[model samples]
Target: MSDATRPRLKVLAAMSGGVDSAVAAARAAEAGHDVTGVHLALSANPKSFRTGARGCCTVEDSHDARRAADVIGIPFYVWDLAERFRRDVVEDFVAEYAAGRTPNPCLRCNEKIKFAALLDKALALGFDAVCTGHYAQVVTRPDGSRELHRAADMAKDQSYVLGVLDDRQLAHAMFPLGDTETTKEEIRAEAAARGLFVAKKPDSHDICFIADGDTQGFLAKHLGTAEGDIVDEAGAKLGTHSGAYGFTIGQRKGLRLGNPAGDGTPRYVLDISPVENTVTVGPAASLDIHALTAINPRWCGTTPAAPGPYTAQLRAHGSETPVTARLDGGELHVAFDQPVRGVAPGQAVVLYDGTRVVGSATIATTQRSTPGPSGA
Candidate 1:
């Protein structure tokens, strides 16, 4: 479509009071589109705590976003999304941990809160698209389907976390930072040049709802601690754990096992059985898995053909490995081309075709495949 024939789009930019989001709003306004800035208040009561210049959804963050919006000559608003964020992201994170799974709150926030809920609200308000500072791209294929691709900056690429977005959501999404071959420093420089207040602010990490980086502490405080038994793979009692939620697959430290292995080698957590109130330990090699099962799979577009080999990453920063994936019933079965270590349940398995994200699903279980005899 020619620029003259195209609609004069109204874009809603989700500003997080960061340099990246500030630059994103600026870029959107410079693109000749009517732009508005929105800051989602995800915390239950943001006014209770003094806002910091570096945190997300803080009172100071709202102020920073408002300043950016003013500089960009766009209207600004703060939407109270605390209730939805609690139910969709925070509560789900706690529930997943209570069930002995390590959940990614960022992914859940993007899937349920930002892209799904916020996108719906923007569309209802007559906005043509919603933009964010996420470092991922939306490309239109020859078939007119929108494909999610990695950002130009590999270190800041966020495609894995955004793999849950479906095609329709991608169609109405904008990522101005995706095409920029600039680093965080450069973005901050641009913001500083524009005299934006958040130019020098540090990035926020960890679960946003959790005050500190204490996942176990947060779980214990909310869910209450459940003492459990730590045992060997054969179900023989080896030690006692403070809580099952505190442990994860392949964790070798903090076991506090009173007994050592027969070979005097340190053992690792191979599995956690919540029903049995036990954490199984064995040789570290036992953490290797050749195959895994995942449920609630969501593809970027339609489901791809089964029995196709693709690249899969177990975690956001994890290395991508070739795998053969197939849909079985309602679950996804994936067999790695090579053995992978520490394949934990509850982590996301993101599938990709080169730089394009295909889909992602939560890992349900992992199993070790029997090896062939030597010299076969």
Candidate 2:
């Protein structure tokens, strides 16, 4: 489209000092948007440099982001959102672990910080939309309603973490990376061609707050320790542990069992009871779940016209399993056609109709179809 015909927007490009964000910001500018790059300072005390791909939000990252903005010829600024991130993401993660639940901090960051806090601030500053490098598409329908869809590169699609964004947020969101048909390698190549400094920067994989990638140590430092027991299906004590919050469902390692089962079968953690301070272990069969309940559901679009079939995803990169979902009151109930394993509470359960994200909620509890053996 010509500049005369294309819609010009005052856009805020959220630069994460990564190659993807740099390329995305460049694309936004090329598309005729009056883009301004803003790197978010999420860490209270950021390190001077980043060590490998351990975490994000270091001072070095901010430098890279600023340089990218310079190359793109857009005004750059650093927004200090450390306090908000600590309150919303870090505190929530610690509390969820303390309650014997596994929470995904990335989803919370998108929901509360990036789209909510940052977007709100951007609008107040006269920006029409907050553009990011996330690999997810926002499509405008014929009726002018926006829908969030998976990126062209399925392997790199980030729609799961963005499932919490409601319709309102979707209206003011722009994903330049999602509009591309290329892969991360190609994006990095484009950045290098454009003389961006972050062209070869490593991708960050660990949680931002847990810099050392030691979730257990982080939680132990924040929430302290509570002695707990490792028991079998029959409540027969197999071992002891220092904390119940340290363990998660479907975990097989770090159990430190004093004695192996009589049948000599491998054991996996099936449940974690914070109140009882116990970790329940059993055979792999016990991990099979037929139904699950999720709390605090957030739908991206309007409520489903009717309860029906929808693919449910448990993890960000995990396979989408066929299931039926029904929302009651404020909770979501999902029934799987086949048994699903390794589902943990406090994890976000995202529902999708094909590649388009419908909504998501936090897993509260799961139900089994048939009870396993008493001592299994």
Candidate 3:
């Protein structure tokens, strides 16, 4: 939309102290929107400086965001959401692991914190939309309904993590970086041209909350240590582990198994049972899962009433697999055209129709066929 035709909106841009958000906020302002920058203080005790680019939410990041807002000539502020982050993302991560399921903290944060909590507060304050640096597009149909789609930059597409956003959230969401075909280097160049100091900053990686990037160690601290038995499908003990929650599906390394398979092939983590306090290890071929049942469905638009052909993404940043899925009787049933391995409970399974995000749900259970004499 052109500046003359587009309505000037009271935009609340979420500056994450990175080059992308700085550039995104600048773009929103240059588009003639009444933009104000806000950085989320997700950590209560924020670190003074980040260790390389491994994590974010440090005291130095807040300063970068402030300087960017100054260069953009927009008012800036920091919102302390530490308590909410702990209760929603961090605690949920620990609880999911304790229940013997792998969870995606980024997806949870997008669902509960960014869209739910932060968006709610923004709307309550009379903001027209919440703008972010997420590389996902929001398309509005002629019927006045909104849809979320993948970004033009496929390499940086974040639609999988954002699949949890419902129609309501999509209505008030703005992603300034989504429609761009520019590369990351181009984005940094844009930031530099705009006089943003974060132009050359490294993109944050790993779990932002985990400073050391040691997920198992963080979980052990929260869930505590407990010796558990590692067994086979037939309940034959193979080894022992400090905690069953530490291992996830398709995990091979760090298993520390004392015995190898009968055929001498390496074993993979097949299942985790918190109830039994047991971790199941089996052949790698057995990890292939044909079907899955998921709950807590969140759709971008209308809910599908019948089964449809689409693609299923089992993890963020993972490849999509062609599948047949249906939302029936308050649950999602997905049958993969090709069996996918490493799927675990508590992970979000996002469905897509081509580039458009159909919806997402939490994987509750999966059905796997055993490899028989044919080894199929």
Q: Give each model's whole-structure lDDT.
A: 0.83, 0.88, 0.88
TM-score of 1: 0.93
Error of 2 at 258 (Å): 3.0
Residue-wise C-alpha lDDT for candidate 2, range 1-376, written one tens digit per residue: 2111237899999999988888889998998999999999998798922567877889989999999999999999999999999899999999999888999999999999999999999999999989899999888776777788888788889999999999999988888888567977898899999999999999988787787888898888998888888898888888898889899989999999978888999999988888899999998888999999999998888877678999988998898999999988888999999999999889999999988899999998888765743321
Q: What C-alpha RMSD separates each model from the true structure? A: 3.7, 2.5, 2.6
Task: Give the Å error, residue 181, model 1.
Answer: 2.0
Q: Model 3, which residues run further than 4 Å from truth?
A: 1-6, 371-376
Q: What is the lDDT of residue 140 in candidate 1?
A: 77
Off by over 4 Å in 1: 1-8, 47-55, 370-376
